[model samples]
Target: MNTQFIKASLFAAGLLLVSTSFAQNKNDLKNWPSGYAPLEVGKRIAAHFIATPHTNFGRPTPPKVITYPESCTWYGALKFAGASRDKELLGQLAKRFEPFFGPEAKLIPVPDHVDYSVFGSVPLQLYIQTKEQKYLDLGKGIADKQWGPPEGPRVVAASHEFYKQGLTWQTRLWIDDMFMITALQNQAYLATGEIKYIDRAAKEMVVYLDSLQKPNGLFYHAPTAPFYWGRGNGWMAAGMAELLGSLPKNHPERARIMKGYQMMMASLLKHQAEDGMWRQLVDDAESWKESSSTGMFTYAMITGVKKGWLDAKTYGPAARKAWIALVGYIDGNDEVKDVCEGTNKNTSRQFYLDRKRLTGDLHGQAPILWSAAALLQ
Candidate 1:
């Protein structure tokens, strides 16, 4: 036998062994401990979200237009409902959107910035689950407008410049844009099976990855902000996972995005605290443990392991421990605690450290549902 042939055979055998282990580990997640079951936890969170009226970034006063945080939490609940196969819960979730179509139509946000465009994700998800034409139209419209000309008054000066480069007009270099922009486009692709939607998302992702991802595989809060703010990085982690979960396997951008994703996951695994939580400032040991970032990272890891992108033995336990640790932070009210408050990019490390930790914020609530739905899937 040729030497090269023998080496190839050994490599192939090793891959088979790893694949088998991943399948077994994936099934093992089903045996979760009491109160840690993903379906149960998801339903509880979904119920809480349904009962709670929409608020602006977790504030009691509802915003005039539905914003990204609430939209994200809504999307999470929808995903959980679909994953758990809870028709009643799904119907209830649908009811929540009925108001948006009627008396609250005024609340639909104009698609200008990345945040506003993300609102499309909710309706796109609804259309997928229910095949409602109204949902499809609403979602696809919002997504299309994201790539269209400036409709809202807040267009950045470089908006057209970004658009000319085959990116969204609303493209901003914030790490959060990875999720806010790609997620909506990904959803639009899912809903319509349109290559354009996914292509646009993939293109936008590569740009952000090249511009923002640091040598260490984590991202700064912004170009000017050097700190690895946990939730900010969490957004990137979740975004890459979301896009990869759906992007065509043979697509040109898949390999690059996957590389970026795996690099971030490795860095995240390194930074995970002994408690299985990640700190608000990811690399800062003294920073407080944060729920939102922990949940987002857990979601990403769970996705990677499930999809066989990660080595199951290495990531399987980490994902599970992080999920359990994240649940422990949920208060008696079903609200996740220790969520860093709505953050803006700042160069000051003290600003991130001193930020308020809120309970029941949709920013926190969303990721727990994401992880739950991911595990269930």
Candidate 2:
């Protein structure tokens, strides 16, 4: 045999082996049943999002401003559309934003609070999917203002204090702020390929993890509020997953964030109910099973397993079970039911327990889309 023929055969065999390994990794969830498949679930949720009007946390009235939950849902829909190669759905999702730039310009959130700043993630995802200059300018502008010097007539003292500390002027040390802040900055990094955005996000995450994460890896609603609220911890879980999903492996803060993420995931795994849902207060078995937090945690786990940040054998089954259980909460109207109402950091456990359970809340809708999109990826 010619020496060159032997070399070519070896090269081809190596290429085939690598390609097969990649396929196996990507298709880890390939055994999913037809109705529960990620593609099917993702498309259904995307359609629901496109058809729904702007909501004020599941209330009937139209929102005066675009809320972070809506922004999150929009971002998730865009991701699902892009991943599933649904050009029509992508165009429809894009059209929904046209009003924001035109007649409804007033609805674009002012990035003075973490909740408002998170709206940037939607347009950044839009720009990433479509490469639209207008989207980039709009999204990047919002992300920049979060860390910009305090300005405008509404600036607060906290803004100045946080800014001086090299944190976002909007920082409040709330657990949910982790997701709100990181989502915008991480998306900005993905869209612009700028290290500054990701670095800011990673550094900020370190601060939140150090300050908020407890010995058990869960977080209290706030320093003064000692209750382990489900959605609050869910926000942190999802935030860490989102950040680690993109942060470079060699980045200085990656290991710390990864450690925080792994610790939290293990705790969540222990607290998961027999039905695969987590409660309004994750550590409290007596608290009602909540959809939004459950959805968020499921999304985080799905992302972790898909990214190899989690062990597939352990987290994969948990994530799959959670997704199926979560979807069961979707009502015939395509709205997720049993989502805890909008909550505040309160020391009283009853406050969280008594919060109204809502249907069709974008808070719940967003994470279902995120989990579905992640699984498809």
All models: lDDT? 0.92, 0.89
Error of 2 at 356 (Å): 0.9
Predicted model with the maximum TM-score:
1
Query: Compared with the true structure, what per-residue lDDT tens digits does model 2 show for residues 1-377?
Result: 99999999999999999998765544355556557787888888889998888878766788889999999899889888887888999999989998988999999978878888899998899999899999999999999988899887667887788789888888788999999999999999999999999999998999999998999999989998998899999899999999999999899999999999999999999999988899999999889999999999998999988888889988877887788789889888888999888888888988888999988888888898888888888
Residue clash pairs of candidate 2 = none
Superposition TM-score, candidate 2 onto the true structure? 0.91
For candidate 2, the per-residue lDDT at 8 reads: 100
Error of 2 at 143 (Å): 0.7
Native-structure RMSD, model 1: 8.6
Per-residue lDDT over 7-76 for candidate 1, one digit per residue giving the tens place of the 0 to 100 score? 9999999999999977676436667878999988998899999998878876667798998888999999
TM-scores for the candidates: 0.92, 0.91
Which residue pairs in model 1 clash with each other?
Answer: none
For model 1 the local lDDT of residue 46 reads 91
The candidate maximizing lDDT is 1
lDDT of 1 at 222: 88
